[model samples]
Target: MLIGEVARRSGVSTRMLRHYDALGLVRPTGRTVGGYREYSAEDVRRIFHVESLRSLGLSLKQIGRALEDPAFTPSALVGDLIRWTEDRLERERELLERLRAVDASAPSGWHDVLRIVELMQGLDSASAARRQQAVLARPEGVAVPAELLVRAVLAESDPNVAGALRWALVRSGGDVVAALAAGVRSEDAGVRRRAVRAIAAMSEAPGATAVLADVLGDPDPTVRGHAALTLGRRGVTGAVPALVGMVVEGAHDVDAAEVLGTLSRDHGCADRVLTALAGELAAPNADSATRIRLTQALVELPGTTAREALRRLAHDEDRAVALVASAFVTVLDERCREDRV
Candidate 1:
C-alpha cells in the first residue's frame, strides 16, 4: 500500500506516519516509481503496535525502545507506568477535592475562589504552623465549608493544628456531626481518636450525643475514654460504666472521677455510682493503688452511701488506702457537722 492507502486503512494520519518514518519507528518497506513511500503489510502492523503502546501511557521514546530494543524487558517499564498512572490519579483526586471544597464554599467571585484555594494549600502544607495558620487566618466572614474542616481535622497529626481545625469547624456553623461520625468509625485507630476528640467539642450539636453514645464501645480504649468523659459531663448516665472503668484503669482517672461526681448529683445515679465503685474496691484482683484511686473518686459522690463506703474503706487492709480513706471520712464528717449548723 502507498502512504495514502496505509494512512486510510490504519487510521494513522499521513503526517504522523511520516513522522514515524523519520524517527525510524515505522519506515516504509518500499517505494513506488514516483518515489512516494510505500508500506508493506508488516510495516502497517508495526504502526498499529506503536499506537497500542501509546495507549498504555508510554512516551514516544519508551515506545521506540519497546518496539526496537530486543533486549528491553517490559516488566520494569510496566511497573513504572503503573506507578506514574497512580500518581496522576492521586493528583487528580486531590484537585477534585479542592474544587469541590471551593464550590461548597460558595465563593462569590474569583477573589473568593483564590482565597479558598490558598487556604486549602496551607492546610495541606507540610509545616504544622502553616496548616494551623491556614485555619486560623481564614478571612473573617468567609465561610469555609465544614466538610473541608472535617477532612483536615481527621488527617491532622499535629495537636495545635488539629485543635485549630476543630475550632474552625465549630465556627463555620455547618453541621459536621455526621462527617466526623464517619471518621469515628474509621478503621484507623488514630483517625477514630482524632474524630472522637473533634466530636467531643460538638456535644450540643444535633446527633452528636447519639454518635458519642455509640462510640462508647470503640475497640480503642483511648477513643472510648474520651467519648465516655464527654458523655458523662453531658449528664448521660450510660457513660457511668465506662467512667468507672477509667477510674479503675487509671486512664484520666482524675477527670473521670470529677465527671462521675457530677453524675452522682442524682440520687438514683449516685447509688449506682457508689455501688460500682464499691464493687471495684472489693474485687479480689484490685491492687492497693487501684483501691486508692477508687477511694479518691468516692469523694466526689454526694450521699450517705459514699460516706459510709469511705467509713468502711477507712479500716481497709491496705495501710495506705486506709489512711487516705480515713482522711476523706474525717473531712466529710466535718462538712456534715457544719451543715447541721
Candidate 2:
C-alpha cells in the first residue's frame, strides 16, 4: 500500500507516519519503482502496535523498546499505563454524566446560568450523597461532602486520586489522613463504607493500619471486615492487639475470622495469631464443629510456629481439643518418620 492507503487503513496521520519512518519506528518494507514509500501488511501491524502503545501513554522511545522485544515485562512500570487510562476514563465519564444531568435539569431561561455553575457533582460517598440530595432539592449551594469527596480519592488505584483529594479539600495533608481515619467512625453508613474502601487502597503504612483497626468497631460488619483485610496486607504488627480482640473477645465477629487468618498468612503476626489459636484450644469459645474446622486450618498452615502452638494444644484443657491434636500429632509423627516435619 502507498502512504495514503496505509494512512487510511491504519488511521495514522501522514505526518506521523513520515516521522515514524524517519525514526525507524515503522519502516516501509519495500520501495516502489517511482521511489514512493510502499508499506506491506506487516508495516500496518507495526503501526497499530505503535499507536496502541502511544494511546497507553508510552513515549516514542518506550514504544520502540516494546516493538523490539515481545517479552517485555516491566510489571510495575507497565501497570502505570493501565492505571492512567482507568483514571482518565473515569474522570471523563464523570464529567459527561454531570453535564447530561445538568442539561436535563436546566430551566428554559437559565441554561446559560446553570452552565456557568456546575450542573451537579458526582456522588461518591454519603457525604457526597447528601450534597447530591441538596442539589436535587434546589437552591442549596453544595460542594461535595467532606467524607464523600475524600472517600472517592482514596478508592482510586491511580495516584491521580491524590490530586482529586487535594483539589476538593483545602485541609493540610496530615488533617486529610486524620479526617479519613475519623471517617471510619462516621455514623453515616455510606461515609463509613467508602472510608473503609479508601483506607484499604492505601495500606502500605502502619499508621494507616491503625485506622483500619479503629474501623473494626464500626456497626457495619462489611466495613469491619474490609478494615481487617487492609490491615493484614501491611503486616502491621500494631494490628495484633486489635486482631486479638476481634478474634477472641468478639469485639467484631465479622472481622474476626478474616483478620485472624490474615494475621498468620499475610501480616506475619506469628506470636499473636498463635496465642489466639492456643487460647481458642485451651479454653472453648468456638463450638465443637467450628473448633474442628479451626483444627484443620491450623494443621494445614505448615508453619513451625503453628505446629508448636498445636503441640502445646495437644495437652489442652479440653479433652476434645487435646484428642483432635493427638490425632494430628499422629500425622506429625509420620512426618517425623520421614524426617520432614
Candidate 3:
C-alpha cells in the first residue's frame, strides 16, 4: 500500500507518517516501480505499535528505537510508566494535605506553591522526569506539546531552577536521574545530545556524577563536550581522566577548551589536565586552535603548577604556539623561581 493507505488504516495522516519516517518511527517497506512508496503488512504492524505507544505518551523517537528489537516488550514499558504515574499521584496527595490545612487558595510558602503545581499535574516528579526525557528525545523539526514549552520557560524563570532540579535529583536520586540518563542513550543523535547537556548540568546532584561518567564515550563530539564541561564544573577529580580524554578528542571545540580551562583553575585537577593537554598538543593531528587555547589557559592560571606545565609545552611543533608558551613561561616563570614545591 501507499503512504495514504497506511495513514488511513493507522488513523495517522500522511504528513505525520512522513514525519514518522523522518524520525525513523515508521518507514515504508519498499517502493513501487513508478517510484511511489510501498509498505507491507509488517509495516502496518509496526505502525500499530508506533501508534499504540504514541497514545501512551511515548515520543516518536522513543517508539522508533523500541521497534527495532524483536524482544521489545510494550507491556513492561507500560508497567514502568504506570509506576511513575502512581508515584506522581502520591506526591500530589501529600502536597494537597498540607495545602488544605492552610488558608483558602493561598500558598503558605514555596512548598505550598510547589504543592499547588503538584495538584494541578504540573510538578509531579515522575511526570516531570518523563516529560523532560520526552522533550529531550524529540527529533529536530518535530513539534513538542505546548505545555512542555511553557514549563521549560518557567523552569528558567525561577532563577533557582537549577537548584530546584538538583534538589529533585538528589531527593529522588535513583529513578528520576535514571530516566534522564536513558534519554541520553537514545539512538536519535539530537535526543541523545540534548539529554546529555541536561545531564551534565545536573552533575552536582547526588547520583549525577556517576551518570556523566557512563556517557563519556558518547558517539557525538557535542554530547561528549557538554558532558566533559559538566563534569569539569562539578570538579570531579576522579573524572579528570575521562574528561582529559574528551578534551583530547574535542580539542578544536571551544566547549571542551573552556572546561579544560576550568579544570586548570582547580588546583587538584590542573596537573592532570595540563599534562593531558601537553601530550595532545605534541600529537600530529591536534587542532591548531586547540593548541593555542590550551597554551593560553596554562599561561593564564595563577598557580605555580600552571606555569610549570607551560614550560614543558614550550617545545611544541607549531612555532607560534611554542613561542607563546615559552614567552608566557618566561613572564610567569618567576612565580616558580623561589624554591617551588
Candidate 4:
C-alpha cells in the first residue's frame, strides 16, 4: 500500500505518517518507481501500533522508544501514563466544576464570569486568609453561587475559613439545603460534621429542620449531638433523648442542659424531658458527675416535677452530687416564689 492507501486504511493521516517516518518511528518498507513511499503489511501494522500508543497519552518520543527500544520496560511507563491520565482527568473535573458554578451563577457578562472564577480560586487558595478573603471579599452585586460556597464549606479544614464559607452560603440566598443534605450524608466524618454545623445555622431554611432530624441518627456522636442540640433549641421534642444523652455523657453538657431547660417549658414536652433526665439519674451506673450534671439540668425545668426531682437529688448518696442538687433546689424554689409574686 502507498502512503495515501495506508493512511486511508489505518486512519492515520498522510502528514502524520510522513512525520512518523521522519522520526524513524515507522518507515515504509519500500518505494515505488516514482520514489513515493510505499508501505508493506508490517509497516501498516506499525502505524496502527503508534496510533494505539498515542491514544494512551504517550508522547511521540516515548512512542518511539516503546516501538524500537528492545530494552524498554513498559511497566513503569504504563504506570506513569496511568498517573498522568488520572491527574489530567482530575484537572478536567475541577475545570468542569468551575464552569458549572459559573453557568449556575447566570453571569450577565464576561465581568461576572471573571468575578465568580476569582472567588472560586480564592476559596480554593492554600492560604486560609486568602480563602476567607475570597469568600468575604466578593464584590457587591456579584453573587457567589451557593454551590460554590457549599463545596468550600465541606472541603475547608480551617475553622475560620469554614465559618466564612458558611456565612457566604447563607448570604448567597440560593437554595443550598439539598446540597448540604448530601454533605451531611458524606462518608467523611469531617464533612458530615461541617455540614451539620452549617445546617444548624440555617435552621430557617426550608427543610433544614428535617435534615437536622435525619442527622440525629448519625454515627458520629459529635454530629448527632450538634443536630440534637440544634433541634432541641427549635423545640423539636424528638431531640430530647439525644440532648439528655449529651448531659449524661458530658458532651457539651452545659449547652445540652440549657436547651433541655428551654424544651421543658413546653407543657406537653415538660414531663418527657423531666422523665428522661430522671431516668439517667436513676440508672445504677450513673456516676456522681453524671448525676450532678443531670441535677443541674433539672433546674432549667419550670414545674414542680423538676423541683421535686431536685429535692430527691439533694439527699443523694454522693456528697458532691447532693451539694450541687441541694443548691439547685434552692434556686428553683426562689424562681417559683418569684413567679408567684
Top of the candidates by lDDT: 1
Question: Residues 292-325, candidate 4, lDDT per residue (tens digit)?
Answer: 8888888888777778888887888899989998
Candidate 2 accuracy as TM-score:
0.40
The TM-scores of all predictions, comma-separated, are 0.94, 0.40, 0.44, 0.94
lDDT per residue (tens digit) for residues 192-298 in model 2: 76666665665653366677777766667567666765665456555554555454444454455555666677655656666666666455456664555456446
Error of 4 at 241 (Å): 1.0
| Model 3 regions more than 4 Å off | 1-175, 245-269, 300-306, 312-317, 330-341
lDDT of 3 by residue, 184-295 (tens): 7778776666556556655665676787777777778766666766777777655555555654554434555565666667645666776776676677776776677667
Position 336, candidate 1: lDDT: 87
- Superposed on all Cα atoms, the candidates' RMSDs to the truth, in angstroms, are 1.7, 19.0, 18.5, 1.9
**Candidate 2, run of 10 with poorest lDDT:** 116-125
- Candidate 3 overall Cα lDDT vs. reference? 0.62
Better of 1 and 2 by lDDT: 1
Clashing pairs in 1: none
From the highest TM-score down, the ranking of the candidates is 1, 4, 3, 2
Off by over 4 Å in 4: 334-341
